[model samples]
Target: MEISVFSIQKSKADNFENEIKEYIKMSSKFAKISDLTIFNEKIAKAQSAGSESALKSYDDIYEPNLKGFCIALDEKGEKLDSIQFAKILESNSQISFFIGGAYGLSQNFKQKVDKIISLSPLTMAHKIAKLVLFEQIFRALCINANHPYHK
Candidate 1:
């Protein structure tokens, strides 16, 4: 399978980035995966304006990038167990997960995606959320392959 995680944020050199890299390395045996960080002067200006503007900006930028088996991480989305999450991976050869910016994804954007999922009910930092999503993706792959890593 091929998986891509798209996040609305500038690239960062930090511990979370290091940990995310580790998960990507570990997941290599199961599938090809990549993380794409997106942020530009336009997005920065939108963010400075307000949450609503930032969300609109996110929709504009992300809508065109939507690919096969698209999934958006949203606070109001359904919560799935690890096994359930693994099932989605087992069925889809190409998957794209979107992690919205600080203001969060727009309701219309989430509605347009194939699936909307929530990592947790509580809000988390963008980098931290990316790290968690990477770890879970690795775990889901392990579960699907009957690998010991999941246990």
Candidate 2:
């Protein structure tokens, strides 16, 4: 199965970018995967401002590029544990996961996705979210392969 991660911001810190790349490399060892595609938010500011230009920019970019089974990360989404997530990953025919900008995904974007998944109830920084998500994907791969690392 092909998995893609769509995010709204670029990696700002060198350390975080390196860590993300490390996980991506580890994940690729198990199976071929694409780099996290980062989309530039038009506003380049926090979402609370709700700039029209940003909303329009997102509409033009996010949906059209997202294909296959789309999953949006939202606080209100169904919460799943690591093992269940592994099952989901193993069973998926194709998947695309979206991490919204600081303002979060728009209502229209939310409607287009197949499902909403919450990584945590507490709000997380986008950078941390990316790292944690990649780690979880790696763990899921380990579980699928029955690797000792999972234990």
Candidate 3:
């Protein structure tokens, strides 16, 4: 399986970098995983313009990547347990997870994706959110393989 996490954030050194890499390394045992951080002048400019503009920019950037079982992480989306998340992985060989920018994903973008899930209702920094998502992905892969790590 190949898993890709696409998040709208500036790529830089972060405190969570080491742990995030560890999860990716661990998950490598199960699937090929890549973390793609996207941030350009257009996105930056739109962010300062306002929430609606920022969301539109997010949708414009992320729309092209919506393929092969896409899932968007949004606060208003459905809340799923680990087992349920694992069930999603069971049937798909390729999965792409979209994490929006400061204003979150737009309604149009959410509708374009196959599924939308909320990691938490509370807001979190992008780095922390990425770390949590990586960990859950590792756990879900373990569950699918019956590797005992999920327990």
Clashes of 3: 0
Candidate 2 lDDT tens digits, 109-134: 88988889999999998888888888
Model 3 residue 127 CA deviation in Å: 1.6
TM-scores of the candidates in the order shown: 0.95, 0.86, 0.95
Question: Which residues of candidate 2, in runs, are more than 4 Å off?
Answer: 39-53
lDDT tens digits by residue: candidate 1, 4-70? 9999886687738888888999999999999888899889999999998999999998999898899
lDDT of 3 by residue, 48-134 (tens): 999989999999899988878999998788999999999999899999999989998998888889999999988888888888999
lDDT by candidate, in order shown: 0.91, 0.77, 0.91
Q: For model 1, which pairs clash?
A: none
Q: In model 1, which runs have C-alpha deviations exceeding 4 angstroms?
A: none
Stretches off by above 4 angstroms in model 3 are none
Error of 3 at 136 (Å): 0.4
